[model samples]
Target: MKVFTYSEARQKLSTVLDLARSEEVIIKRRGGEVFKVMFKKATPSSPFDVPGVKTNATTKDILDAVHDSRARKLGI
Candidate 1:
């Protein structure tokens, strides 16, 4: 993913920090759109890859699945 444009990433900001350490630089602008620059993907902390936080469903399992989908759409 290498798009760049904002004046070619401000005139090659050090080759976009060395292609954002591996890959992912987008940037755009001279017309608008495009983005990504990197970083932001560090959450998973156990329960084997976070299967919905290893199935624990709290907050009363999201208000019991929003009160059982508003009591099955009112048909209680």
Candidate 2:
């Protein structure tokens, strides 16, 4: 963990953020107000991130459905 004054944090914002990626950063104001910075855990990407019509449809089935809908809309 690292501690920095408010002015230091403002001047070295980028460095503070880079360090925060690995550890916690504490900022202390002149009037004793303090804050901490930390990184949130990243979420892993998934192919099924879409929301709607939850079915056991395969990828090909979904693609075909989308194509058919678009064709209808375009009068093709």
Against the true structure, whose lDDT is highest? Answer: 2
lDDT, candidate 2, 1-76, per-residue tens: 9999999999999999999999989999999999999988666588776556868999999899999999999999
Q: Per-residue lDDT for 9-50 in model 1, tens only?
A: 989989886787789898989668877787566787876875
- Give lDDT per model, in order: 0.83, 0.93
What RMSD value applies to candidate 2?
A: 8.0
User: In candidate 1, which residue pairs clash?
Assistant: none
> How many pairs of residues collide in model 1?
0
Question: At residue 14, what lDDT does model 1 achieve?
Answer: 91
